[model samples]
Structures are given as C-alpha cells and as structure tokens.
Target: MAQVLEFRLPDLGEGLTEAEIVRWLVAVGDVVEVDQPVVEVETAKAMVEVPCPYGGVVTARFGEEGTELPVGAPLLTVAVGAAATGTTTGNGSSGGMPSAPAAGTPGTAAESSGNVLVGYGTGAPAARRRRVRPTASAPAARVAPADEPAGAAEARVAADIADDTEQSGPVPVISPLVRRLAREYGLDLRQLSGSGPDGLILRADVEYAMRAAGAAAPAAPAAPAPAAVPGPAPRPPAVPTPTAAPVPAAPAAERIPLRGVRGTMADKLSRSRSEIPDATCWVDADATELLAARAAMNAAGGPKISLIALLARICVAALARHPELNATVDTAAREIVRLRDVHIGFAAQTGRGLVVPVVKDAHRRSAESLTGEFARLTEAAREGRLSPAELTGGTFTLNNYGVFGVDGSTPIINHPEAAMLGVGRIVPKPWVHQGELAVRQVVQLSLTFDHRVCDGGTAGGFLRYVADCVEQPAILLRSL
Candidate 1:
C-alpha cells in the first residue's frame, strides 16, 4: 500500500496566474524521480518545465496538451513508495491478485514531500506511525480518464447532478473556463454546489446550469427580417434575433490564447502605457569616434569589448550626471524615488518573443564584464531559460533597436522604472566635423522618461551627454 499524492501547478512567480500545457514529459504508469522535469508549460513570462516533488509512479494526469490550467490546478497524481509495477500482488494476496493491507498494520510505505512548490527535492521514504485502512480499490485502476465508461458525457451528467447540491459558502472552481461559462450564461453559482472532489465546480457544472436555466425560462419569438429598401439601395443584412435555439457558431479561426510569454508582454506593456506618464526625446549622434574606440579596445584587448557594452558605459556615465533620470515614480506615495544603484535592462529579441534581460549593478561593472554578462543573458533569453530575477529590477533600460536595422523608436518605459534609452542604426552620413562636412558614423538615440520622475531639461541633458560621448569617445574617460 502506498499514499497517492496529487501535485498541483506551482506559482511560477512574477504575478502569473495561469499557464498553458505545452507538453507532458511523463506518461501514466511511468516511474518518475523526485524533482524530475515532468511537464513543459508556457506561462506569460517564460516556457518552463514543472517538476514534481515526489519520486514514484505517475498515476493520473489532469489536462491535455494545449489546455490552459490555472495555478493550483492538479497537474498529476503519484503513488510514492510504491513499485513501478503499480500493484501489490505478491504481499498477502490471493492467487497473485492485489489485496488490501490488514488494518492498523505498518506495512504501507508512504513519504510526504516538504518541497512541493518552486523548490523540488527528494529524500528517503519516511515511515509513519499512523496508517489508513486499505479501502476496496483497484490499486492501479484508481485513475478515471476522460475515455472511461460512458465517456466524458456521463461524467459531465454526474458532475452536473452533484452541482445542484447546496453549499455552505462559495463554490470551488479549479479552471477559469468554468467561471467564464457561468458569467456568459449569467448563472448564479452561489446557489449551486460543485460536483468535483472537495466540491470543485468544473466546466461541466457551469454548462449544466446553463442548460437548466435555458430550459426553465420561456422562449421568445424570432423577429421577422426587415423588408427590402427601394431602388439600388441595398437592404440591411437580416439580423438574427434571440430565440430558444442557440445559433450555431461560425467556424473558429486559428486562435492562440494570450496567456504565456506573449500575454505577459502584453500586460507589462499595457501597464507601462497606462501608469507611466512618459515622454520621448531623440537626437542624432556622430558615432565615428565611438565605433573607432570600440575597434581599438577590441584590437588591444585581453577580452573583446562589445559596442553595446561601450554604449552601456556611456549610459551609466550619463545617469551619474543626470541622476534625476535614474529613478522611479512612487505613485502610491506621490514621490519620485531616486535609486542609488544602476541596474540596466537591455531588450533582446528571441524566437519566443521580445525579452528584457537586466544587468545587475551595471554601474559597477567594466565594459569587458558588461559584454560578457550581456552575451550570457542574451543566450539565456533565446533559450527561454532566464529566471524572473534576471529579467527584472532595472532602474533604466538600454534598447539597441539598431541591431534590427531600425533608425529610431519611442520605446515604452519598462514599468515601475522611470526611463528607457533606445539606440538606432549607426550608418555613414555627412556631418560637420571641425566645421567641414564629412562622412561620419551617425546614430539616433531616444530617451523615454516618466514625467513624474523628471522634466525635459534633465532628460535632454542625459541624452546630450550620451551624444557627446558618442561623438567623442574620450568624454567617457573623464567619468572613468
């Protein structure tokens, strides 16, 4: 006998409430080790493999691929301390059939996992002094899949019937689908109890309630189509009025749910637009010297310095001069909070989507170190392996849209932070050098800052300093 434990989806931090099942790594009846990558899920932030804390045989899985499950929904159940064969046929059984353990016997080996959420771990099986009497169960046959007898329809019917039971308080819903169904039908779920284990209100319960409500209500007659208009004027399309019969829906288009990495981006960008009262200022910079400086550094370098790192160095130096821009707007307290440290965020586009990876304590690192860190983070972002910590806590952002061949962008502030600096393509352009026109490496730089954090003068000062450094790289030596 073994204890069967259900593992629910853990909170994949950064305010993500749900995730879509991309793939299942372990199948039913498969033996799994503790902390093994069990399923691949796409959250609004990143694609991650969720691990189970228990080491044993997987018994039942809850959702299918492409299904969206809310946090706290069951991922799978495992029978820990049980053999991978899934049956106790040889121990005190008749004719090699699986049998129940004697009551009050210490025969069942069960272990409880302490690390069930973010940190998964394993240890030796713990023996318990208290035990449960083995009930009449089929051991491995404890799982009821969607393809069971009478199929999902029967389960829905049974669950719906159970939904009619009165509850003491609020209904327990495991999936967001159930709540959406009820809202669409205007069903008062407080009056109905749930049909699932522990009174969980499932999608079936909502649909059943919808059908019941529709059946109990009186039907209305359909309105006749309007008469045709005179002459060449086209008659308005006949509007279908509400009736007892549900109108068949048009064939669905290929729809992808906005719930994972893409969804998080949408949310963050939206919030940044809504909460941060921002403004953008741009200027063209002569980058001939900056590019030349980079070449010199690389040619004479122990560790090659990247152009982005040199730009980062300029940004850190500019922030030191214009400290007002390196701050956040404290809306709740109605104050501008200037930060002491400079953690920079750089936008990196990957196959998954656009991600902003932060370089911690960027003001303290040299150009060589910044180059190495950016390379590491960019690789992590492309592979979808960046942790939430690596993706957040930036006081300012450096977005080099130049890599994409763009000339300029009014970059939205990465929220809570006050400002972002966008750099554009550096191409050869005729410019005044020593009062004479000459071809120079020209780049456009844009700074988007929160109005609550600073005024245009401060922002202009920061951008101008950045431009000065680009036009004459030796200006950075003064700060160094």
Candidate 2:
C-alpha cells in the first residue's frame, strides 16, 4: 500500500499571498529528496528557488507552468511508502502518470526530473509534457516548370511582394493573432520580405498581396499619337509617411497581484509613509578633514572605512547627544519610544532589492567594529543571506546614493524612526580657508524627518551636530 503526501506551497516569508511559478524541476512520478530544489518562483523583486520539504515520489502537479499560485495551495502530490524508496511508480488514473512524447519527434518535450541529487533514489517514471508543433496546408496549384532557376524565380516573387508592400504601407507584427492571420492567408513570407526590424513580415504585407491579386486587370485600348504637352503642371502636395502604431499601454495602475518581498515591502512602506509625519533638514559638510582622518585610520591597520561608515558613527554619536533623534513617536498612546540600544540600519542595494540590514548597538561599537559589521552586512546582502533579524529593528536608517554619483536626495524616512539621513558624493569644491579660497572635499546631506516627532529646528540642529562630528573625528572619540 502507498501512502500519499501533499506538498503545498509554503509561506515564502514576509506573509506573501502568491508567487508566479518560474519553472518546475520535478514532474509527476519523479522522485525528489528533502531540501532539494524542486521549483523556481518569481517574487516581485527576484526569483527564488523553493526546495522540496519531504522525500518522496512526485505523484501529481496541481497547476500548469506560468500559473500564479496562492500560498498554501497544493502544488504537487508525493507518495511515501516502501516503493517510494526506489523504483517508485505513481497511480496512473488521475493524470499522475507521465505522458512524455518519444524522442526524435518535432517539439518533443524534455524531462528535467531525474536523479537530481547524488545518491538519491532512482528508477522513477519520467514526467515530461509534450508540446505541439504547428503545421500548414497550402492551396493546390499547378507546379511551375523546373526549367526556371530557383534563384531568379525567388527574385521575381520578392519584387512583386515588395511592390505590393509599398502600396499597402507598414504594419506591426507583435501579436499572435497577426501571425495566425498571415499563415491562414497562405502568405508567402519569403517572397514578401518583412518590413519590421530584423526582416519580420507584417500583417499589411499579406493584406496588400490579397488586394493586389483581387484588383481588376487593365482593359486593352488602341494606341494613338501623343498630344501636344501643356504648360508646367502644378506639383502635388507632399504626402507624409505613415507612422507605426504605438505599443499598447499597460492598464493604468497595473494590478501587480503582490506577493513575497514586494507584498511585504508594500505593507511596510505604506505603514511608514501613512503613519509617520516626515520633515527634512539640509546641511553641507566639508569632508576634507574627515577623508584625511579615514585614510590615516585605514593606513594604521584599522579596517578600510567608507564615508557611509564614518557618517553612521557620527550619527550614532549625535543621537547619543540628542536622544530625541533616536526615539520613536507613538502617536496612538501619545508617548515616545526611547530605546536603550541604537541599531543603525544602513540601506544596501542587494540582488533581491533594497534592504536595510542593521548594525546592532551601533552607539556602543567602536569605529573599527562598525566598519567590520558594515562589511559583513554588505556581503550578506549581496549574497542574499540576510535574515529577518539582520534586516529589522533599527532606531535610525541611512541611505547612501553617493555611490551612484548623485549629489543629494531627500530620502524617504524608513519608519518607526523620526528621520533618515541621505549621504551624497564627496567632491572637491572651492571654499574659503583663512580668508583665502581653497579646494575642499564637500558633501551635501539631506535629513528627512517625521514632523510629528521633531520640529524643523531640532532636525536642523541634529544634522549640524552630526556634521560637526564628521568634521572632527576626534569628537566621536571624546563623546564615547
């Protein structure tokens, strides 16, 4: 007796509702092992491969390819029993048996579900789907004499097609319906060269061919002597060339049918934007001294510190001075959430999307420690290994657009916090030094705040204080 087990789509993290199936590695009747990748699903931001949760023989596929499956939906059925150990055979009554086409046939389906893992069970039935190839039947006509060379006849046919195309004008060929129409009309594509890019024939070409063939032939008339020419004839107005039709616009506000990371991002961003009252303050910082100090620190066996790491340290110090910047506003209870620890979340661009991984107890950590953590977080982010804990629970957020060569932008405040700091690129500009103009490395900082929690003056002062710390790195050491 075989024991059947159902494999439902798991909650792919972040309370997502659905995920678009990208590809299936296992098909019906194929054996799969636990923790082996069985399917790839595309979330809104990136494609993630889901692994098999149980070891068994694949019995059924619940949905077809390209289907958007909701979470908790049964995706595949598996059999767990003695036969499931090896040489597993599935029940054939309920579309569970593989029906793959034989090899060497046109459009033969390929099977990917074999012994995918080393030392995995074998002798499972192959589960592959067949794809149909289209065939066309042309109208019967008298065959041309073989005396005519194929090349010359093809050229004449091409010229005739060109003439017809010129008369009918241009047409697009993106839709499947258009291709079907062309095939049904018995349009000789080789004769009528395509007008589209890369020589793709259009619907207009077929229509023109049909119309030209249907037109009445000229009637025979008697030839006569030419009449005397009249005075210069008036020139006809210039006719404008027809433009290609614009590609169909997507529906206004496409229903993304959100799932996975996008769904989570939407919920979080909406809550932050709607619940938080944001305000911003601007400050220009001269980073000449900060750059020199960072170079010295790096040269002296300290980890290579980026401007973002230095700024984060300065922000932590400033928050220490003014605890309000680090506090969260609870409008519901009319209270402030002042936490004892500071977790500075620095926004890092990752393969999945924009993620802010936190540096826990940022204020307590030394500059070198923060630098090491930043490096680890960035590496984890790029490798798509950041956990929920690493991504969440931050007293403040920082966005560095300077890497993309941007000067400054008012970054949207990542919620639960009153503000976020935007760091810009450091560039050398003219500045007054002891009443004399000299080149100095300057950077613009934009701090976006939640107005409900902080006034403009408080926000401005906090930014100024942070800038002061950056201008004097020794200030951070003294504050600590």
Give the number of the best model, judged by TM-score.
1
Q: Scored by Cα lDDT, where does model 1 land? A: 0.73
- By TM-score, how accurate is candidate 2? 0.60
lDDT of 1 by residue, 117-210 (tens): 1001111112321112222221222223546565664455336434532232113332324444554455655544554332334455566666
Candidate 1 residue pairs in clash (backbone atoms < 3 Å): 43-260, 44-260
Candidate 1's TM-score: 0.66
RMSD of 2: 16.3
Q: Which ten contiguous residues of candidate 1 have the minimum total lDDT?
A: 115-124
In each prediction, how many residue pairs overlap at the backbone (N, C-alpha, C within less than 3 A)? 2, 5
Residue-level lDDT tens digits of model 2 in 59-82: 567777778898999988665433
Best by lDDT: 1
As a whole number from 0 to 100, the lDDT of residue 345 in candidate 1 is 95
Model 1 misplacement above 4 A: 82-254
